[model samples]
Target: MEPFMSDLSALSSALAATAAAAAPSLVSVHSHRSRASGFVWKSDLVVTADEALADEGEVIIAFADGTTRPATIAGRDHTTDVALLRFDGRDVSSTPLARDVPPLGSLAIIVAADQGTPVAALAMVSKSAGPWRSLRGGDIDARIELDTGLRRSSEGSLVLDASGRAVGMAVRGPGRTLVIPAATIERVASKLETHGRIARGYLGAGLQPVKLDEGVGAMVMSLDKNGPAAAAGLRQGDVITALNNAPFSSMRGLMRELGPDSVGAVVDVAALRGGEPMRVALTIGERPA
Candidate 1:
């Protein structure tokens, strides 16, 4: 019984130490009555969850020391749920990110800030898998799910591994808490820093799903004269069945193939033109903001 009690006490102490080490990087993001967590990414940049940020409002970042500063949205990507903010203030050091994904069932510490006060939660890595696509068609580098009850104020908190190294940023997913892995942050945040938005592939045709004899298809209802669909010779009323040899039964399924990585790639389009089968090559273009 004494040994068991000692083990528990050691674990509690270790968790407190880890939380203390990560608290300095955390900040509370406030915008138009919406509050969320964020962390210092670079010298003058902070990263937070995009979904929690309001579209048009003055944003403020409150540090653990109770100091606050006005920040501007440098860049934001809805697909990855990451938003970068640029602020004028003293530089805060960011925690080291783990190069590799943490193993399943490992200890995970969630460090967040609530209105400039530090908060912590302990969880375990419930699921760890390879790269996956979000329902919105964003490509995430790794799939990491945590078994923990995440608070609304901790949406963009820093998720750290047992060694106190950051694994990723914590965000609320469809009824669950998910970690946007470190590799994904590095990829998307860097682009956001440069371009302020992630480019997505666009076909420039308004499509609606329709039931066909064999399966489902997207019928083009409108066309942009100067868009990729027009360049591929696609006209209104053409029912597209497949793209690049993969069949899609819904509009979302087809759009899933047009993620950021799909931009600038040429694809083979399979569609029916006036009851006749036709094939055309289309070069995907960037979607207009």
Candidate 2:
């Protein structure tokens, strides 16, 4: 009984120490009347959940020491649900990110700030899998789900592994808690910092789904005079059946293939022109802002 009690006390103390170490980087993000959690990603940049940030409001960053500062929306990617805030006069250091995904069933700690005070939750890595795409067409590095419930104020909290290395940022998924893996944050946030928005692939043609002999296809209804589709000799009334040998029956399925990672890719487009099958090499263009 004594040994068990001692071990439990040691575990409790270690967890508390982990939370304390992350407290300095944790911050409470307030937009309009809503509040969410965030962490310092750089000296003057903070990362928070895009979904929780109001479209139009004065953003505020509250530190754990009860100090507040005005921040501006540096950039936001709705597909990835990451928003970057820029501020001045504060020198906050970011936590070190874990190089690889934590193993399944490992202990994961969520650290957040509630109005400048640190709060934490302990849970296990419920699911860890290969890369996946979000419903909004963003490519996630890895699918990491936590066995815990995230509070509204903790939407963008930093998720740490047992060793105090940051695994990712927490966000509310459809019905569960999800971690946006560290690798993804490094990739997207850097781009967001340089370009205020992510560039998506563009076809420069209006498409309408049509029933085909075997599967569905998208018929080109209109084309931009200077667009990639027009440059690739894709004419109006052409029905696109497949992209890169992958047949898609819906417009969404086709769009999903044109995520941010496909912005500069060259794809083989299989289409029907006047019932004659033809293939064209098309270099995807960036969607115009």
Candidate 3:
């Protein structure tokens, strides 16, 4: 059913007012669907250097014209798809995420478009290292769940705090959404802008930690050959029993154990090749994209 004009007008008014008041703090970017390629810049966000985003993925902005843009993909970290982009920053206005940044264990609510406009919502801070999720019919993860706000938000809406500081950017979700923290985004932006993409090392394997069945060794899934694991002969289904002789129950533990140096160093991978206990010493490769 068509939304009542009065309701749309009210919402537009509220959003417009908020944006107008905060426009100085936000950058506005304007791009349009080009008959040739994709979207061409109609305009860019204009803001002081202080207000300019650090160059991470596209920032969601309010257009003075009342139109919305989805987003442009830029420097993406394979390990973390946190990217950067320029936006049609003309109407640029947004209430930043709150300041008292959510604690390490605090919750984050990120709203993005499900259909058209954003519906307010929340997402639990799964762990310090994300892929944050917003569960359906379950207690909120980040103490934040969409209260029906994702619909109007584009993929790049900034999730703000009560005071209007940016904390999280809405990226993806079903009931569970993926958001890149602002802090992480800031760190990745400069590099992305300089390189047009993320410039992280490559480790070609996609590995997952799983509880092995009795008699089964460590379990690895989501194999990526170009990753460190594959470079080190770590193949899919290669059950990991030990990393550098450290017994790990989870992949996070394993990754932590390897750390950054693992990118170029060789590590002993103890595993059950096929029910027979064995070991394969492979050199860790670069961080694969």
- Which candidate number has the best TM-score? 1
Instruction: RMSD for all candidates, in order, please.
Output: 1.4, 2.1, 9.9
| Structural similarity to truth (TM-score) of each candidate | 0.96, 0.90, 0.49
lDDT of 3 at 266: 69
Supply candidate 2's per-residue lDDT for 61. 91
* Candidate 1 vs 2: which has more TM-score: 1
RMSD of 1: 1.4
Worst 10 residues of 3 by lDDT: 33-42
lDDT of 2 at 154: 96
User: Which residue ranges in model 3 land beyond 4 Å of their true spot?
Assistant: 1-17, 22-62, 66-72, 78-81, 87-99, 102-149, 171-179, 196-215, 218-239, 246-262, 273-276, 287-289
Question: What's the lDDT of the predicted structure labeled candidate 2?
Answer: 0.91
Cα lDDT, model 2, residue 25: 88
Q: Which rank order by TM-score, best down to worst?
A: 1, 2, 3
lDDT of 3: 0.45
lDDT of 2 by residue, 159-261 (tens): 9999889989999997889999999888888999999888989999999999998989999999998999999999999999999898867877777777887
Pairs in clash, predicted candidate 2? none
